[model samples]
Target: MSAIASEVLISRLADWGVDTVFGIPGDGINGIMEGLRRNADRVKFVLVHHEEAAAFMATAYAKATGRIGVCLATSGPGGIHLANGLYDAKLDHAPVLAITGMQETSVLGTGYQQEVHLDRLYEDVSVYDQMVVNPAQLPALVDIAIRTAYARRGVAHLTVPNDIQVAEAGEQPYQLVAPAKPPATAPVYLPPPVRPRDSDVRVAADVLNAGGRTAILAGIGARGAGRLVEQLAVALDAPIIKTLSGKMVVGDDSPYTTGGIGLLGTGPSEELVEEIDTLVMLGTNFPYTKHLPEPGKVKVVQVEIEPTRAGLRLPTEVPLIGDVGATLEALLPLVTPRAERPLLERYQAKMRDWREKMAALENPERDPIAPQYLASLLDRLATDDAILTCDSGTIATWAARHWHIRGGREFYLSGNLATMAPALPYAIAVQHAYPDRQVIAYPGDGGFAMLMAEFHTAARYHLPIKVVINNNNSLGQILWEQMVLGYPEHGVRFGNPHPDYAAWARGCGGFGVHVTKAGDLETALREAFARPGPALVDVAVDPNEPPMPGKVKYEQAKHFAEAFLRGQPHKASIATTLFKDKIAQLKES
Candidate 1:
């Protein structure tokens, strides 16, 4: 038996520490698939419907568990299926390998079935791309791909011709390469430090002396300074509000815990911030500049790692650049204690009010279930520590608003691009690496359809991921966009009758549950959550009533009115205007 033949390709993958690989099987990879079937002991192959979802699974896995995510595909159509997810991984800086199986070696010059040059096709999307013509080169090439993926800079591609995968090894000895360790940061700062504006110190004093209300806005950076954040809040006796990304840095149930702010903000967190005389912007570089209060109006002090992020939001009364934890620690010693603020009580009341109003959306009586209730119900049934991966469009809006991330749970998202169909693949990587933790795939019907084939992959490996598909039949989010844009809805509609997602799950030897009503929700969710293996929960939801991320202000309102009434394009050009600086950087780079 030739060691390099396609007959035992799984052994090489096993040697590379890969337990399962995500991809759909077809022409070019038939050899590899056969090899996997013959020696199922070592490595298993996951079969997704589209190579795109396969790639997305890799991206999620990398983010959730810090491992190199692997995906494969047949040539031409399969290879083309990977671009969207690959681009998402590139933008999020996730480590992923996209493998494409090419036609037989002899067929290279002739037009064969699905014959597209795989190497050049992925040039724009991948950081490193290669075509392996010799079996001897496979080991080293695979190693390179693994390392590049681990660095999280971009994706790596390996194109294997059908004939080459089955060819005899070149007799030369081969060795697998190990990846390098990450570089360490210096322990201490060198230059003599100018004493930072005791802004944190002043803010603490203001909150203590003013004896009224105060709010702490925690951003992603807050978690890195956990003890300091907790300490500052305790000292000031203040209520804390987190940004979406910073959801549970301070523990969602902390006595001081208020909900998120901006757009789809729930919990009178915005009201709380407005009422407070002193607002501490801790470790967050919130991009929505308009959300900031006027410099002269509020006693705004920002603690940040970057100066540009701090001053860009508003003229900071106190801009301290250092570890947020360390800064907060320094400030804690300087500030006096304070009394209870009525505004904190008021904010908590608002949080309750918002939750109550949103309760209707969660428990809708309409035929199709409300997407909000579907997600909220899932959250209640889910483990407090379960990981949630949200895909783009309406589902993202719903998830961002309703998904309650507890302190220990991780929320993985593609915030930069907000791509669709990422949840399934990400679920793969997350569940594969984290066998101890439960992972959930919260995807919209349209988004889930885009990567539904990944269901087979979930079945193959029996990875314990619960895919909650908000199967509303239409791309409701996009239809809303067209409705508001005043454009003729030429392509936004998607009312196709969906195949039985649950039956497909059962056919693949996984559990599947279809929830059509509010009463059906809890039982299905609990059943899926308790299932020992991979499962799919198909919840048919309402198509109308879009998610609310922002208030319908004059600009947004005008756009919708013009589009629906006069059929004219509205002014959402504010996004372009806001991102002008980023555009300039792109040009310079």
Candidate 2:
């Protein structure tokens, strides 16, 4: 609503169980701010400095609480800032209602001051986007947008024109409709797929029966099928490997879980992929295909609820197109259970070995620091129920690998969009939205540098978000990419002019610490997490570390090999040749 006319909308917002909104109020929303004044007691508003942070904060709150996350902004520039953030929410299936103030409805096309078509601008990212130019249309439109956001499980934008917001309304009280939500344990259904008993299921069961070594790779589709996978694993004595996206589907404690495979994966699954006699894939489309052994070694049987994904990647030996849970339930009866193999025991032993090795890697006694060590220390000291939010880039790689998930902690990240600078906002949202849960945000130097100013916002609200800044002074992941690609590592550097992130946090009335070496790192992290309000722990790390389990495309590798074989060592640059020991000797240089 315009600064002059936000009464009814604000009143109705409180009715919708919107206690706290994430946003930085501006001129376009001046009217709404006035309306918000009336709702001070009923609603608590968190005024963030950046619209992107606001959007993400709302998204985090909504995701954690399973409520409609609300963010408000003014039209034109303010609304434009929401593009990247809205995309994150959309991809994550988060329910976010974006309320933006627009120019007067009369001067919209006339290009009046701060005039831009936000409704259209937001259309692509939002499942529902509309301009409420009429005051009378609001009660219904307001109700509809919220409903669409809830049902669609994505972002919805409502652009309220200034004039309409300021216009007089009917004296009737507007009631916000509560969105219906299914309980967490609700049974999800899939369309009945014609899995012929003789053709598909029977064939898949036969493959499982014949295979001496079987492994089931479950994706997000296998979410509700954890128990089924457990039961099936017991029947076949097969281990389960999950994609990063499907991490929560099956608990890590399950004997079937051998850890994730592909990029950012760890544990025995890395080598287990080659040994599998049959790969039974569930509801996943892992991007890397070459990582799979030749089609001959590992026969693939895939079950997917979505029919389109049945034979998506490697052509499936048997495509059982059915709900993941239902398909496993049906197939279990047909297959004969098998005894655990010696190799299975070896694989389990490797998992235990790697976990111990991982702990040592984090608390390494070396002089040159490892970022994984810092993360592990943070992991140990952080709140038991802390919501760990991570940014994309090198820090993301470390967090995904080393940060173990316990029952108390849940992860927050932009899995699809993979945008940076979401860490600060997600941290704010997690703490503000789920005050009960301990929350921490892991941001790379580049990532944290982007939204460093938000520390003031954190201080303003005294939001209890602990930020772990992996300060390598560069986009470490890209640096690794440059090296591995045989390209000269350049343009990824962030020099001394970089903001003293920890100092800035202190300046902003929050806790701050700077650690430059590997020693005493755990103590610093423990102290940071122990602080009451917001805290920033800046730990410098070696940029030369390799991003684990990364692959080289056949085409790219062939081209590079041809170049290198033709005597282009100079052309390969320092990065390409030093993939393994990037920190070797160069540290002395």
Candidate 3:
């Protein structure tokens, strides 16, 4: 029996182990919707409120599972809305497949209604961008798209015309002029174990062995190789500074770790980056050159899967171009173990002091609840195996510093893109992926308000995802950036009052709790976690409280003072809040 191209496409994805697809139904792509209806048992369609959220959900799935996340959208506006989220996947190196619809081929280039050339639109962001004009192209095109997405660790886009979607396909695959066989019969492309050459490994080992004070910078690329990284750290007696993407690579509980680097980093990490003479970068291309040591001052050893990224960030004495785990495994045997790690011990002590300093801010007695307290409380209340995601804002800083990853917990954020409004969608996708696991979201008021409708998606699906909103009613991060850049805070605050998010959650058929007082915060969180269905807790936090950097630069302090002097709004309140924070720290000391 002949099958429609849409069915063929859906079937191909199912065969490749795609169990769920995130998208919304539209008339432009009715045929694909019908295909989904037919294959309901094999491939489940998760209906999202918007195409942007759908793409975000797909990216989240890819990040959490390392599988090719698929999102569907209709032509024109629908496809256009997907750009933001697809870029998120592209920038973060998540393998994602985006399928968008196009107008019927009969219209050609007649400026047909919603006749968007999706292939051209996606060219910049996609690894493989193509439009299907023939039914016979599915078997090869789908395979190649998926394969390229995996190979490049980026997005692949396929646009099917309205007519082409329902076209009957022949049993035989399209013949393409290529050196290799048709991809239809090609087994799923799984990345093979890649290790660096013996000479390169030896060179890297030599650099590490000769260093006086060494440090390891691990990124998302170091994920799944946690044990190997930890072993390497112990062998070298080096401190591990994680990029935000790699926060879970080694738990903050580990003595060797000094948490993160850059603006959202810990005090110990800042010191470690500046003081270390030798730096070993593992599977991370951390871009903050200012936070990194001066190039010629520190000898560098970098291991990367992509050869192009090896020396992209800094000059490298040894560039081990291979998979992080395999390269580290090969190098570990050659590395000489260090006996007395006075530098490592010193940083460990600093890490303890930093933790204490951070912990002191988690005060429950504060009138307007501190964001730090909320983050710390969430850390304590959340399950050991919970999956946590936070929006890109001051919320990220709080999550990075306060939430310590322990047990089987995994954390994700916008990372490189630093985009907002991803946490809720990420939570929904993760909850859908692991129905039994606890999935939580931490988004600020500004971000949550962007894609607030997605809460209904969770409610409609009856996902037991928990959302914790740090209701500060301002663009906290950008506001601070302006102050630090000597500009008065302008158009940063959300006017008047913010919506009652708890009421919105309840309206969407989910559990809701609004906590305005510090004493009520813990009870609301406990209630949200205990809910059987989707729940949201909107906790009012101090808007004036700044997310201070680990090591405040001299220029930053000077600029902040200038901003305050030059008619910054709410300057007195901000000054008072800053003073209270310092007083609390002094009392703790």
Candidate 4:
């Protein structure tokens, strides 16, 4: 018997080195599910509680592994559910292929059950969108989807009709053409390294040499070029400022780095951006344009593999379009080394002061379990090579300011989209990628509740993921945002009492720990880390504790005061905590 289209689809994916498929199954995709089942030894299907989580898992897997992440969903609602995560991949430029089911070709527009125009629905989010109407189209379509995703560094979607999925495929050899090589029977596809031209590299070097104080803003693009980035920093006597996605480029405690940039950044970094004459951006188009040095004030030399992203965020005097490692290798030789290191020294000192200020906030003896203290405790307990993920909101703030990046540790969060609840799913995918490494997910109460069912998914897989929930019982980030905008906090708090997330973990066949007091936080985190399987540590933190920006503007202070005057909830406690934190920061200054 000829192989079915679904079998061809899975076979082609495995040929592209895809080892896992993340998705939830439904009747519409039953044929595809059988394909996954038959090819279980080749490509494993991870069952997710929700289609959205599956999409998130795929996006994160792509980001973490530098491979084409594939996600599957049934027709109609399942396909619609994938939009958010696919958009996340698009914005962050993760290479992902979404395989969603469609109604039978006979009833595509007849409004049949689960009849979703998935190809039309995915056009905006995908770099390549197509539907397989025949079995012969499956293998070629799969190859095109994966190739397009890799080439464009964005989502590629292939929607297959139910009838087409089970149809017999024609005899076709699976041929994979390696870059600059003839077609081979073996499945091997490797992307060619991108390099900037010598002339462009020289122009960038000239721009850098012209400036006196140069600061390197390392983004996610500098992931594999840490040593090169350090060499350039040392040569220029420059301080490195990491974007959130670029946190692992260098350790947070490195002397060359002033820590992160933007609102979740360090005060020294803010000052460094204000003072630098030249800014060297590596592989990161940081979305917060306001935090960047004003155009023309700093001569910008940007290095990026994607040409469109080179000058997107800041005005570039010289844009070197190429791989970060390759570009840095070419430009570093032409750039002149500096001897005077006053600016780097000054920023290093400020970074030390910032660390001291943060230490005071991370005091474990504080009565209410401070989220900073919880993050610090987890940092102390996690392994050197642990992979940590955090959701957006106050949890991200705590993770950003408190958790120190050390050793081989890596951190990931929703970068451009800044969506909530991806932490748990990301942790699951990373754990699947590296089973032996410690994987932790830190999410706020609101975000955790959004995708809480995924905890059971972790349990089902025996993923051994440690989830630490910052149970503030409120949408803490938005509450502060409202206050910052001079509006009273409204509808951000959870009117219903918060559920026992720890208990839920236990119910889902995992270990659980609840820490209501500050002193118990360390013990709880330690226990969760040591547990044999998936675990949850739910710590009730102070909801009134604000995530203050690195440098508070007078307008922000005025608006916060105005919010209190306009009768904000928990105004007294919020004001007290903010005042106390500010006083500590001022003392460090």
Candidate No. with top lDDT: 3
- Residue range 1-589, candidate 4, lDDT tens digits: 5567799788889988999999999988888998888789999999999888988999999989999898999999999999999998999999999998888888878878877798999889999999877665656677777887888899999888888888776423344474233232333446767888888888888888888888999999889899999999988989999999999999986889988888888888888899889999998989898999998788899998888888998889888888899888888899899878888788888888889899878766665777888888888888999999999999888898888888999999889999999999999999999899999999998989889999999999998999999988999999999999999999999966669998999999999978899877777787788888999999999888988889988999999989999989698887677776667667656
List ranges where model 2 is wrong by over 4 Å.
1-8, 11-16, 170-213, 219-229, 251-254, 274-346, 550-589
| Candidate 1 TM-score over all chains jointly | 0.69
**Model 2, span 1-589: residue lDDT tens:** 4333366676666667778887878888776777788678887778888898888888878767778899999988999987788888887777899999998766778868889889888878998999876555655666667777876778989888776666675322244495333222211222345343456888898888888887888776676678888787777777788776677677666555777777677647767787777888987767667666566767889986556657777778898877687777788889897765565567678777656655545545544567777777777676656678889898877886777665556777776688889888888888887776678889998888778888889888887788888887888787656545656556777676767778899999999988887776777777877788888899887655556553334655655455455554344333442442434323322
**Candidate 3 lDDT tens digits, 438-484:** 99999999999999999999999999999999989899999999999
Where is model 1 more than 4 Å wrong at Cα?
Answer: 5-17, 25-43, 102-117, 130-144, 160-250, 255-263, 267-353, 359-361, 364-368, 460-464, 486-513, 533-535, 561-589
Residue 498 alpha-carbon offset, candidate 3, angstroms? 2.3
TM-score of 2: 0.81
Tell me how far the alpha carbon of residue 263 in candidate 3 is from the true structure, in angstroms, after superposition: 0.6
The window of 10 residues in a row where model 3 has the poorest summed lDDT is 178-187
Using lDDT as the measure, name the better of candidate 3 and candidate 4. 3
Whole-model lDDT per candidate = 0.70, 0.74, 0.91, 0.88
What are the per-residue Cα lDDT tens digits for candidate 1 across 129-194?
A: 998876656566666666666543568888888887667754223343853322332212132342
TM-scores of the models, in the given order?
A: 0.69, 0.81, 0.97, 0.96
> What ranges in model 4 sit over 4 Å off?
171-190, 582-589
**Alpha-carbon RMSD to native, per candidate:** 10.0, 6.5, 2.2, 3.6
Could you give the candidate ranking by TM-score, starting with the highest? 3, 4, 2, 1
For model 3, the superposed segments whose C-alpha errors exceed 4 Å read 171-184
